[model samples]
Target: MTTNQPGHTFQVDLRGLVDLLSHHLYSSPRVYLRELMQNAVDAITARRALDPEAPARITIRTGVGGGITVQDSGVGLTEADVHTFLATIGRSSKRTADGDLDLAEARADFIGQFGIGLLACFVVADEILVVSRSAKTPGAPAVEWRGRSDGTYAIRTLPAGTVTEPGTTVTLTPRADGSQWLEPGTVLQLARHFGSLLRYEVAVVDRHGEATRVNDTPPVWERAYRSPLARREALAAYGKATFDFTPLDTIDLDIPLVGLKGVAFVLPTPAHPTKRSGHRVHLKGMLLSDQATELLPDWAFFAACVVDTTGLRPTASREALYADETLAAVRDAIGERIRQWLTGLAASDLALLRRFLDVHHLAVKALARYDDELLALLLPWLPFETTDGTVSLDEFCRSHPVVLVTQTVEEFRQVSSIAAAAGLGVINGGYVYDRELVHRLPQVRPGTTVTDLDPETVTAHLDSVDPGTELAAAPFLARARAVADRLGADVALRSFQPVGVPAMLVDNREARHDRRRAELSAGADDLWAGILNSLSSSAPRAQLILNHLNPLIRRLAELAGTADPQLTETAVEALYGQALLLSRRPLRPSDHALLNRSFLGLLDFATQAAGAPAADNGTKDPR
Candidate 1:
């Protein structure tokens, strides 16, 4: 017997809606001021469309008990407009009487962040009083609308001459807890904070009847400078005030197509790759968000920026840009502007380029990982640690036509000095991006070859000892070889410079990794051991290279067949242990055992030689 109605009015509870806006939609209650300013801007923009000479001004007055009145000489609402846009919570510019709201049309005419116009006021106020006269319609009666936070609103046609001009006046009676937000000090601060760069004139009137103008200063990028240094100093001051740190440098940014202008501050210190703070963005001169991250490309995280745009529109919350085709292009264009600054520095200013790279090289390196053109432009300027001391990649590459690089820090340390003594050029590529960048150099510069260095490669460059010397030290070499077999290593005698190093351990990364897996497999459960053993590789065994040119090896050779044969065993353990220490690789169980046994054996030998009682070999208190 009953027919269900498919369409019905949405029952909006104003109290709950206000709370939702304060807690979720808006970042803070202070943004209520921004919402008001945006509405004023929207109205003024609409009025200017009909009448270009329309007064572009907004005035705010504070009264007793934290009440605020905001008046704007903008297109005001008629009776019907008031009912639809103000009294009816869900109604807005989009809705027409007969058809659905023209979404594009509504958005185009009122582009200044229609953040539930006039409804946001209820967040800080218990009751809102609005009196407006239509600017678009002549001989229209002024309308008065009173809306409260209890979901009640009333509308009435006021007397003909109550509002003399075509504009809107909104008065808010602050709630008990919102008094501080509406105070004179807070009003002034917030008005200037949100409206300082607004194109329209905004004024705040005090209790004593004096009005202070807010929006007196233009944005930093628009300011006139006496000279380049003067401009730099001004921008530097602005950077310090806004970001709380002195920037290393600044890049001026402009996108004339979108009527956007800003400055990017290169941070004085490194920035984390993720979790970056957002840029400050202003729409039509009002601050939309101080945290508009999507406004720039992801690579722009190293720079802090403040931009003002009239060409882009904000989303519903009015906090960030609505992502669309235009926004994507704008971000690309802004990234290009920053890119040009670096190229410009490369072309003209070497000293400045060096300074900037010292702080932001990592950011550039990250970008260069993708862009080949940027890599080519900045390759020479990049720094590298070479055997000839730290130098430019250009200098290192030019001197050593075939560049040699090490993949890890310890490997570079093992061979850097010896390679230098043997007239070999080696570059330390242990740092992040170093190896990849070195590998990529040939792609940019034609004729440069990058070689990967390992212990075996360095060993190939050392001079070989004569066979007769090896024969003379055959017995001692046998002892060394026996000790090396326990650690799955072999022994070699080579004559190289830096003879102070008695022995050196040389192993490539793959061999070291495979050795570690074998060690782990030895100690694992049966199932785990099988799984780990399956992962092992047939890599080259590690080598303990003894320096035949060193005096220590010569003395050991003299005691080849001594009566005390354990002397050779103890000496070989100590030498192998020292070589392991120099390599700086993480020690395995076998390595640890060898180090302990060698240390105790050497201590016992030294004590007996000194004719003193040998120290206890067990874990006992010496005292």
Candidate 2:
């Protein structure tokens, strides 16, 4: 069919695109040179693959008035290729859009999949002139395409005198405002940051006709695959280089074919290790993200790793790593890695592992509560009480005569009973409610079962009972009940038989000590306020259980019976204050006030008793 009139093609405003390229695409203008160098590297990599034996060289020449010119002896682009690359938006020559490309399959071969590197030129250059002769055809005519930021472009054959053989030379007339691109220092800086990992040699020609290759292309990624290196060696080298190691405890969680790599030891802790790091993440062998925060769980923020997965889309500038299913797999892999690392450490070295537990106890605890699967794996690393001081779960199970494993509180009570029947101490170190659930041990196991007890409660329970009299603690119990009711606390009186301590303030849950410490260190008032509100409300209520048999309580009781109110009140106030301190709770305002007044009275009494003037000891009137 013949068309009567030609349809108008959609045209982009290159000026606006240039503005976006310079101001929006790059946060720092210094990266303009980096983007150009990366493009040059891509061209070199493609060319070398075609002619492996050929010597590949790139020449960059610049002067104050001449602007910048880059010439590359690579597989030069044809007019058709130029139209497809520059004129088309989505037709990237680097990446394949196949629906099913296995990451494992592709990682062995091709890289640089997304093609948008050329647009970076618009950032600094106001005008671009491309002179290219195709390598595929002999005696092919050299063509030149010129374009400006205004979107106007023209194509014509280059003059015979300046034509080059089988290569491409791009001349960039940079905007006066973009003189930084021509500076040797600026070019070197760009190469160091972005092109340091480039396999090809990148050089710049200074005003004196001298060429300087300013990149270390043989990065660690290119090291011998079979090189034997120790962990400390790698860490030391990374430290000396003044770059972050950001160690990753890498564990491949493939069923049937599992791989575990412990790389966590490589990460260097920053002088001020915040939640951020400068580590780049790679998927498989391809660079996915330089800032891969989501690759790890929040708990693993302390860890820094370059997670290279072969399952992401790298944009043209080789900057953005597009998110996809590969990211999910990465998350799973890292979580499993951390889980296995802790588990293996726990099972192997008990003493060495305890140090890790001590340092990261809060992180461990958080993982235990939220990640039960990981918790089960990490439990072996956790310290537990044993017959011979502190032991790990593995140690406890291995040494104990009767070992019990259960998830619920009732199951814990049953375990306690079994231990008691055999005259052994039951350890309830399982889940969050494991400690609180210990109270049911007596009921489940009857009088024979000695349940696990907190150290504080043990002291109070042991001291509360009198050895001689079984039923003479009535007066003490009555006063404790009155105190509990006044404080609106949960009150209970049970035999401290399981624990050895005389009495303890029991009922408070564990504090978010790590989170609080972090908040305090950060000086985040809003975060602190939120944490304080939650802690005060959710913290377990404490009951003051009096040790009726203890001489201190008995003496106080006898003194209370006396007609002297001042001494009795002072003793009561002191005991209450001691209890509050032990329980880690704030004392009631009236009680605090009473203690203050009684303290003043005691000072006066002591002064009078010592024969000092009583007037000097009296409270000073607020004048």
Candidate 3:
């Protein structure tokens, strides 16, 4: 009982193995077609090594009752070969009995390695039947190998004439779950999707006996690069077929050292910078993946690629390319190709460059961040919003050597109208990547300087009032200063060009923070208010600039001697509240209360001047 048998072997749980192959090893049941096609292609290659004149073709036929037959003209199997290769899992037929065949040195150019490729059929089928004849054994008996998904198989020698040719035919009877794939249209579509670029001829024979070839024989990418005209036509067709959009431009790529060749399509519309670049990768003319994103650089989202490479290896599922040294080199080469296209466009075609920038400016901006060549050429063509209108950086720099830029859309909106009225050009750098590019302008162009147009800068641009006018408005200015202090802002009288605007509230970053904190803590207890005040010690002060050129301010200055001092103070508070509202600043409760009281006081003053009895609480008095 304790003695061990020498020939004992571990049994494979076929059900578990099938489940792993179907769900884990392969990405989808659809890949079963690809694996079957790959095995057929390798078998054809083996037959070519034995007989150079043999036809290498794979023909697929779909039956009415959920059955599929794939027949290939290749080196098939004898009775013993069927038991050794077809029966045994993970046993490759490419090797000889003596030793493992040097696959690299073999003339068959085998595309299959793991014996699991044949087993892939079981993922969609309940049973698989194989009828094959050996090319080496002429006039010998053919063999049939029947394998079931339930871990059982049968091998038997067929009649001498059962298979009249040296080839193999694999038939699959689909399970209930996979019956949808038995349709001729579905089979044909999957064939085209997986084997459209395969070297050998592949045809799908439908239930009506009509045979349609699915593969492109030599593949379009291989032939298109032979001529310039062909390349353009092929890329246009490929783009429309693959992505449903015609490409704006096509870039042909070739890197012989790493065995990479492809075409990159420049998308017509703006692509989000975060989206993954879709690249269709093929290995030895067989489709690998339609969404091979790792083949391109991250910033290359504006382009889609269809590439073929013999050097790169696919993963176990054969669904995607492995990221190896070869792939990294190819990625860099493809990036360089895109870079050359942009630089060439900039050098040769201004009209086209402008057109490209109109749609794909964000992509260009991303590239410019790291690429100096693109930055140098693209900077002049890039457009930015200005006081006049949209203008190119080149035009802006020429007209206004010292560029005035606002960092935010809110800030730009507040100042743009005034800047336009003053005949000053202010660049809106609020958009994505605009501020960073503008800030970097000085590094490239030594004389160009970008100044942030904050509230302080706007005040600096305002004209100072003459000394005589300042003296005449001193009494009104003092009253306004008192009102501004109560509102936590400084008061100034500046002569701005907009005579219609009586007042303007200007604030820098720190000043805005201080004002916000003051408003927020106005309702807090004394301890919290004290803490906030201490924290805001370093914060800047906000300024309320009264327009001396406006008639309202001139009248207020004239009333300095005649108007009651309290009336002057009330008028100053109302003007400051109006300034806050005009600047889009959130008014505090106290400011609202002040404005309400000022309205009532002005109403009472008007009633007194008209010599009419003031209605108490809006009730009309009967006299």
What TM-scores do the predictions have?
0.86, 0.66, 0.82
Of the candidates shown, which would achieve the greatest TM-score relative to the real structure? Answer: 1
Worst 10 residues of 3 by lDDT: 614-623
Clashing pairs in 3: none
Candidates, ranked, TM-score: 1, 3, 2
What's every prediction's RMSD, in angstroms?
Answer: 4.1, 9.3, 5.5
Q: After superposition, how far is residue 182 of candidate 2 from its true place, in Å?
A: 6.2
Q: What lDDT tens digits, residue by residue, belong to model 2 across residues 1-623?
A: 97689778877776776677667665655655554554555555555555666556667776736577777776566666667665665455444333322234432334444454556677777787888776655566777888786777788766664566667778777777776775667665555555444455667787888887755544443344444445345544543453444332222233222121213332323222235444465333333345656656656555555433334555544556555675566567776677677777767865645666655554565566556555555555555443334555545545553433333333333224223433444465555533433333333333323344443333332323344432454444455556555444444443433333234344423323433443454555776766655554344444555444446665655545442445444444455555444444445455576557657766766676699876644443221
Candidate 3 is scored at a TM of 0.82
Residue 210, model 2: Cα distance from true site in angstroms: 5.9
Query: Which candidate gets the maximum lDDT versus the true structure?
Result: 1
> For all candidates, what are the clash counts?
0, 24, 0
